[model samples]
Target: MELQLALDLVNIPEGIALVKEVAPFIDIVEIGTPIVINEGLHAVKAMKEAFPHLKVLADLKIMDAGGYEVMKASEAGADIVTVLGASNDLTIKGCVDEAKKQGSKVLVDMINVKDIATRAKELDALGVDYICVHTGYDGQAAGQNPFEDLATIKSVVKNSKTAIAGGIKLETLPEAIKANPDLIIVGGGITGQDDKAGVASKIRDLITQG
Candidate 1:
């Protein structure tokens, strides 16, 4: 399993500094939806320029015009672009096709999707790179998580790699590892901690051990 550091609340510079601290432990540095909205694709480009070796994900949470959005994000140095699972099949296919052309990837975020298993199966068939079960901030506030949703997608998604995100912290890292997702996403889990590097390092160790 690979660990992804989600940078949602930080600015571009703050995000860069945070990544530098945990670079050794993270496989992907995500320019989260909020940062993307505030800084545009520039956040993706900045992160890529700062750390060329680590993957940069643009959390566009795209709801429409997938091909165009994915193309723009790819040009901005995003290695992976996200499209909502609730989107049309054509939109998802557009993202997959465009991402393939750009040598990038499409990660379908299954947040608020009513039927994760069925949608994951369809997205997998559409050749998405990753199917992620995510609980948004509001959901997380309501005490929701992606664990069960992760299992739902894991059962039927055959071709695509699986991922889980939403309020994942060091304490809960073991539970996420037990789910055996290809990618594990954490935001406040590491970012909110006092010793970011220490927490990230420990999380990485757990993932490696798992």
Candidate 2:
């Protein structure tokens, strides 16, 4: 399992500082959708430039022009890019093809997909690098989580690695770990804490112990 720290609410400089604090513990640094929307792929470039050792994921959550957007993100130094699971198969295929050409990887985000099991199986056949089960902010507010959805994908997905995100905190991480996702994504769970680095370190330790 790997730890991926999601930088959703922070700007470029703040995001960089936060990542620097937990860089040793995290395997991937995610430039989240909100930050990408606010700061552009320059945020991805800057994060990669600052922490060359860590894998940088650009959360494009791309819904269209999948190949072109992923290509741009790859050019900007992103190691992985996200596309929505709800997108048409052709769009998902476009992302995988372009990511291969760019020497990058694609993660399909199953944020709001109604039939996660069915979609995950199809995406696995499509050759995506990772199939992520994500509970969006709205869903989180409604007390939804990706744990059950993560299990749904884990059972059905044969080819692609699995990831889980949204509202994952230290108290809840052990449960998430039991599911054995390839990647565990945490945003405010770490950043919102008073002791960010300490929290991240503990979370890393938990992932390691698992």
Candidate 3:
């Protein structure tokens, strides 16, 4: 399992500082949707420039024009870009194809996709690099999580690697670990803590143990 730190609530500078604290513990640094919306793809560029050794993901959560979006993100130095699972099959395929040309990867985010297992299977066939089970902030507010959804995708997805995101913290991390997602994305879980590096280190240790 790999640990990904999601930088949703921070600006580029704050995001950089946070990642610098926990950089050694994380495999991917996600420039989240909000950060991208607020700071633009410049966030991805800055993060990549700052931490050249770590992989950077631009969470475009793209809903259309996948090829163009992936191309732009890759140009901005994104290692991976995201597209929504609910998007048209052609859009998803376009993302996969474009990512390959850019030497980047695509992650299909299954946030509100109603039929996760069926959709996951289809997306895997579409050649996405990762199929992520995610719970948005609203869903987390309603006490929803991606653990069960993660398992559903794991059981059905054959080609794509699996990932899970949303509100994952040290307290509930072991629960997520048991499901064995290829990538575990945490946002406020570590970012909101007082001891960011300490929390991130522990989370890294847990993933290593699993």
Best by lDDT: 2
> Model 2, 41: alpha-carbon shift in Å?
0.4
On residues 1-210, what C-alpha lDDT tens digit does candidate 3 reach at each position?
A: 999999998899999989999999999999999999998999999999999999999999999998999999999999999999999999998999999999999999999999998999999999999999999999999999888899889999788899999889999999999999999999999999999999999999999999
The CA lDDT at 9 in model 3 is 88
The C-alpha stretches of model 3 lying farther than 4 A from their native spots are: none
Candidate 2 regions exceeding 4 Å error are none
List, residue by residue over 127-163, the lDDT tens digit for candidate 2: 9999999999999999998888999899998889999
Q: Which residue runs does candidate 1 get wrong by more than 4 Å?
A: none
Q: On a 0 to 1 TM-score scale, where does candidate 2 land against the true structure?
A: 0.99
Clash pairs, candidate 1, are: none
lDDT, candidates in the order shown: 0.94, 0.95, 0.94
